[model samples]
Each structure stands twice: as C-alpha cells, then as structure tokens.
Target: MSDVVLGVDIGTSSSKGVLVDPAGKVLASETREHHVDRPHPGWVEMDGGIWWEEFAAISRALVHDGDNVTAVGVSGMGPCVLLTDDGGEPLRPAILYGVDTRATAEIAELTRRFGGDEAILDRCGSALSTQAVGPKLAWVDGHEPDAMAKARRLFMPSSWLVYRLTGSYVLDHHSASQCTPLYDTDARQWYEPWAGDIAPHLDLPPLVWPTDIAGNVTAEAADETGLPEGIPVIAGTIDAWSEAVSVDAQNPGDLMLMYGTTMFLVHTVEQRVSTANLWGTNGAFEGTRSLAGGMATSGGITGWLKELFGSADYPELLLEAGQSGPGAQGLLMLPYFAGERTPIADPDARGVVAGLTLSHGRGDIYRAALEATALGVRHNIESMEAAGGSIERIVAVGGGTQGDLWTQIVSDITGREQLVPSKTIGASYGAAYLAGRAADASCAADAPTGSSVPYAASGPGVDIATWNPPSHTVTPNPGLRQDYDELYDLYRQLYPNTQAVQHTLARRQHRLSNATDTRSTA
Candidate 1:
C-alpha cells in the first residue's frame, strides 16, 4: 500500500519535487536547477531535455528512503509554448511564459485579422498580446516553420511534463484558455473552426480539469522517476492555479496572488467576466470562472537589483527595508522590469524609478521595489473588480510572500486584508494534495481544508504554528493612500508615455542580439 504522494513543479529556474502524506505534510523533497538560453534579445529558450533530466534526478532524490508513493502530479509555469514532434521529441527550445516577447508582429496581425478590439475581446476574453499562445504560435509559423512543421503537438509547461509521465497529451482548462483564439471557455471545448484558420499547423491537446485523471504512469516513466509503474497521474494546471488550489482558493471572490518569476493573480468568480484590462476565463475547477492578471516582473526585478549590487543576502536586505519608513521616503518604482502584461498589455513597457535622490540608499531602493510590485497587484485587483469579480480576500503565496514587507505592501496597496498560507509552497503542495486525493479519497479530501500554518516574520520557508491567522494585517494609511493614489496615476501613464521609445530600443536590442548569435554560430 503505497501511501506517499509526489508533486513535481517545473518552474522557470528549476524543477522541484515534494513527497507528502494525506494530511498535507511534506515528508521529503528534491530540486534540480536548470538554465534558460538567451538565443536572441527578447527571447528565452530552455531545453525540454533538461527538464526531464532534472525531474528524474529529483525523483530519485525524493524517493531515496523508498516511501510508498501512490500517485504523482505535475505542475509548471504557465502560458509557455513548446514545439514537439508526434513522438514527443522537442523540435526547438521552449519559448517560456511571460519572459519572451518576440511576438509583437504576430499580435498585430491577430488583432487585424481576428476582428476589431471589441470583437476580439468578446471572442477570446483578451486582446492579442505576447502572453497569448496564438501569437507565439504565429511567431513559430512565420520564422521557425521547420520547427512548426515538425511539431505534431504543442504543450504548455505543465502539459509537457504530464505527457512525459503518462504518454498522454492533455492540458487543464486554465492553461488551455491562454491559447486565446483556440479555446472557447464558454463552450468548454477547443474552438476548431477558429483554430484551424488562425493556427492551422499547430496541434492542440485535449482539455480537462486539473484534477482529472490523465493516465496511469507508464513503465518507462517509472523507470526514469523511481516510482511504481502504474501510478495514476492527474492533469495538473498552471503553477498559479495549482497554488490557488494549495491555498484552497475556492470561494466566489477568493484571489490567489503568486509572486514567483512573475507576479500573477488569479481570482475565482462565480460568473463569467469579460474585461479589456484583464484576461478572463474558465477556472480549472469545474463550472467556475476566473480572471487573471500578470506583471512580467516581480522577483525578477529584485533579482536584477541583487545582481547590480552583487549581494546574495536578500533576507538581510528585507530586514534593512523594515527599518526604512513607509513609502520609502517618496521613492516610487514602477516594476515593469520585464515589460507589462495585464491591463496595459504592452510588451515593451519598461521599468521606471521616480523620486530617487542622493539621500536614498539601498534599503530605500529595496523598499521601493516591494512597493512597485504591490502597486502592480493593486492595478490587477482594480481591473478584476471592474470586470465584475468580487475580491473580498486575497491569499498570498509563492517565493515573494515570504517577505513581511512584500505582503504588507500588497495589503496596504490593495486596501484589502491578506491571508498568507501557513505553507507558502502553493503549487508544490497543491500537486501533493492532488496526488493524495488520487491515492484515496480520505486523504485531505476536502478542497482547501483552510488548515494552514501562518507565516512568521522570518521569511517564506520559515515554519510557524498552524491554525493561526496572518502574522499581522495592514490597513491602508489615509495619508500614504492619498499619495499612492496620485503615484499610481503616474504609474498607469508610464506605459503610454514610453511606448514609442521602448519599441525602438527593443528592436535595436533584438537586432544586436541576433547579430551576436549569428557571429557565435559562424
């Protein structure tokens, strides 16, 4: 009787595996790091082979003591577009989620051909943008046709891992929605008519809920992953959605705010929503709807600052930020470090730091970064609210929420209370819970047990007692709120103000990067 369950998370920077018991307790875990190749500026490619290799290494590590694993679940970064042949061999490196933005031309073409702005929104629930799989598929068709021709199937990050595990090609509904013109959330099926015309060469897999049974793990996968040959595999979802599951984001207005390589918010709504500022779609849970917003940079901005200053001690920096007073003394940063995605949907949106002066030090800058991310969150919350999604409470999860300053900043900016999960490892834990449910219904059968261990002041990974409320709740200060209201107005305008400049710079940077790559190959 194998009782242990395994959850594998394929992230932007690394792959993590966690083994857990029925009660949401992590027994053992493993991680394997991987790298992305910047073949050209504005493009990010990672070897799918590296993903599988790392998963194998971590699987061996996770089961070193030989626990009885009943089922395995896989989750990964969202909206990633991968090209693979019928037999599941990679034709080209994966164009990862949010980071790569070389699909501007395709987006324009899509907008022109699909319909005017209003019609496009009505059909796909989002305007054509780099985040949409339709545009990325168009990019491959126009520039990388050989890869596209060879591709008999396309998989998002999570779907790719599940395919390797079960030899079944499937995507959860949440990920499928990002395919934009290809998926119809209302119909709950692939929109073959539009898909055939728009992306005729692309192959889309079957859509299912995140917890649906994809298939039994194959013998080959078992040999590679050190698991039993016939374990059941679930159709896991985008990392953010899985994280929502981990936190029990089930109510009508519950929002899951994930701060990882990017800052993504998924709000569960009782009814369908359509908005110009946010992407709305069917949730992974059956019969539910969702509104999603993403900012292309969150921890990426913080990581950039760390690299610029050459420091590995970020926790200490957070402590230093705690010493600084609110608003970072009027130092406001717009964290568009990786360009903007939601609301404005401008791939060329750039980062901005206003009100910087000689008096400000590293702590002020760090605090400003946190404030910028929170402002982005506030923007998303407003968009969702405008689109008719009620946001009564927010559940904060992911690597970024470990910082008390970050969580409080979001709480203050959004002007809503935040509930930080006791276990911040949202996706990994959600995958584990899926596996546990697959093993036997009795294991954490209730969706979102609301049984969480609260985060202490230490950080994301630090342990604290379960059943406790959030360490501290932040209410928006009226004075700072007035100032931020003004700052956010300026933050909203930054994109339009700099769009033309950013476009020119992005093109130049792309050309230079392509020339360098060509020279290297020569």
Candidate 2:
C-alpha cells in the first residue's frame, strides 16, 4: 500500500482537500465551494458547521482503495472569532478576518484601554485593528451578551477542526499571535492578564507550533472520514501561512504573495518586526517571525466587474484587458470596494474610478481593475520593506496565479521577479506536506535504531523544495518602470485627497443600511 497523507483547508470561499503520496505527488484532490454571509454592511461570516461537513465530504472523496492514509493536516481562513460553548458548539457564525469591519468601535475602545497605539504596538506587535481577534470578542461581549455569556471557549476554523478530529483544543502559535492584546509575540505565549480583562469568562486553548502533532484521529472521526484510527493530526495554522509553507517561502528574505479574493503578502523575517502599516506575527514554523500585509479586495473586484459586465468567462476579459495596455487606457481604480486593510486599515475607504470617461469600455475598466490590484501589491511590498522586511524572493501562489496577465502586471508594477511554483493548489497541499512530515516522524520514532526501512534510513522529513519547485519566473518590463512610477504616485495621493468625502459617504451608507434593517425587522 502506498503511504499517503490527507490535507484539508477551509477557505473564505471554499474548502479544499488533497491526498499526496510520500514523493509529493497529488493522487487525488477535491474542493467544495461556499459563500460567506454578509449580514450587515461590514459584517462577513460563515457557519462553523460547514467546515467539518466539507472536510468529511472532501476526505471521503479523496481517499480510495489501495491508498493508505497515514496522517492528517488542516488549515483555514483566520484569525476568525468562533466562540463556542464548553461542548464545542458554536455560539454564532464565525466572524471573518480583517475584511469584517463590524468591530471598529470595539477596536477604538480597546486601543484606548490598552494605553494608546504606541503602547499596544510595543507590547502586542500590532495595534487594535479589525484584524485582531480581541476586538471582535469585545464586539460580541458588548452587542450580544447572551451569546457571550454562553461562550466558554474560543476556536478558529483550524483549531476547531483539530478539536473535532482529535478531541484536542489547541491553537497554533502563528494563529494565536494574530489574537493581538491576548498573545504576546515577545513571550510567545498568551497574555493572561489582558485575556482575563477582555474574555474573562472564556477558556483559551493550549498553544502549539503549526507542525506539532495535536493528537491522533479518534475512532469516531475515522469512521466518518473512512480513515484508520490513531493517525497523527497536526495542529495547522491560517491558510496564508500554509500557502507560504506550500511554496517554501518561510525562510528569511522570502515573501509569499497570495493572489486570491484578497491580495495577501507574507514576508518571512528572522526576528520580530513591527510597523504601524503592517502586521508582525510569529512565523508558521517555530523560531521564526514574519511581517505580513493584506488588501481588502483583489480578485474580488475583478469578479465584481465580470458580473457587472455580464461576461461568460474570465479568459475573454483577460484578452481584452491585455489589449487595453499598461496605462489601462487612462483609467485608475482604488480597488477599495470592500474597504482597505493593510497600510491604510481604513474601513471607510471607498472604491474610486478616477479616470473613467464615456469612451471607456468594459475592457478598459477590467484592465484598470487588474492594474489597481497590482498597484496595491506594490504599495504593500513597499510598506513591508519600510517595516524592515527583506524580500529577496517573491513566491506567487493561489488560484489567481493561474493566469499570466495578473502575475505579469504585478511583476511590472512592483518591479520584482515572481517565482510561480509547480503546484499552485495553495494551502491544502501545504497541509498535506505537514501531515507527511508528522507521519514520517511517527514512523521514525517507532522504527528500530539503524533500521533499513526507507522512512528511517532516508530521514523522516519533507522538503518543500522537493514538493513544489519554481516552474517559471515573471520578470518586470524595464521600459514601463517610469510610467508606472508616476501612476503609483497618483494612486497614493488619490486616497488622502478624497478621504473626507469617502468618510462622509460611508456614514450615510451606514445610516441607510440601518434604516433598511429596521424596516425589515419591523
């Protein structure tokens, strides 16, 4: 029987699973697509039950006859707030990451309570932003006290899966580090005093590294998923970090650029680094750290254009966008349709199409949207560098990287070469690789000393380079550098110049939404 590891990742839009042999070959893969619920203007959520249901479905579909499933690995979109009771039942739909801006008031209150922005940044490695989990918890405490009172524990998708599969409630260090004001990056542990003050009634899980074995799959999970009992299950992390590990981008000086619904940039650094514009968190692996940045929307904006334009598919749009050329035919877009995340962290920011005219077609608008995301990438790269992150190499991953135009645009806008890996399956593949590592370690531990078995003789570890190598590189076009540089300046200035108007519009939109909700409820 061939030894295979199973990996499953719950994402913002879908859940994906993969079965990989010891040699890094994917034997089978499965995906289950789902949508998030937008209950309010800035609220994005999904039912926590969907994660395990999709996992079981994908697991059963991937595991077949003659394939011996050795271990399990998991990853998910986080750092989400999935408060649950002591029995692990969710109190409400999981509040998503930075994209969900419903916690702004809580963020402001927490920042003030924590002694201002500088003190929080110095202690927690990040200020109280929509991304931080503590503020989201506080939002729940203030808004839904009944639910908050019943909440006995906290769990993200990854940790929730770990607990369901192995009956162990634990969170990886990388995920915990994002729970700002609760996890101390300097101490690499939960700050009990702050946690007590914020979520005094809740019980925090034990911490583990992403690669650490949380526990073994129990008989119940094995029965449901058609896997053997007692297989080791790793305590996985957030999807972006797993995506980084998928491409060997966890080393210092390497940046993993994830082209997805939201553009995410993870720059691995050797030591703790913090800045007002970027996030500082523990690396996916132990003994390392990372500076990260994310934009609120990237492919999301393009998708919106596709729907608005009534396009049958993306290839046609890409071809037309290509013809529209570098300057996007005199159109510029802010790409803030869902509000901005890193560098700006402004939830009130609104999308702007500055140069649009009657002559502009759908193709020109599409090209501008693409360029807008590329410009956003460049902005984040600059911010990461300004925060002392060195980007010696950029590894591109995710579904958006499948197309050439997007990657080329990013390379041209950022003036950097991007390495596209052989497997862009993203986080599911990375989780499988981690599972393979854990399984190999278990084999080595049980094997006799100096045994001739392959697991023991060849060393029980998985190398990411062996799993996924760079298939090609996208180099920037030097001729367009001067033009893009000038456009980037305009892109930066457009936000500040239009900030007050955008804020006022945002407030008006909020009031209208509230009125609509009140009418509906009545």
| CA-lDDT, candidates in order | 0.76, 0.89
Least lDDT summed over 10 consecutive residues: which range in candidate 2?
448-457
TM-score of each: 0.91, 0.97
Q: Which pairs, if any, clash in model 2?
A: none
The CA root-mean-square deviation of candidate 1, after full C-alpha superposition on the true structure, stands at 5.5
Error in Å for residue 216 of model 2: 1.1
The 10 consecutive residues of candidate 1 with the worst lDDT sum are: 449-458
**Each candidate: how many clashes?**
2, 0
Instruction: Give candidate 2's error at residue 343 in angstroms.
Output: 0.6
Which candidate number would show the highest TM-score if scored against the true structure?
2
lDDT, candidate 2, at 90 = 94
Error of 2 at 81 (Å): 0.6
Candidate 1 Cα lDDT to native: 0.76
Expressed as tens digits, the lDDT of each residue in 316-426 for candidate 2 is: 999999999998999999988888999899998999999878988888999999999999999999988887878899999999998899999999999999999999999
Candidate 2's TM-score reads 0.97
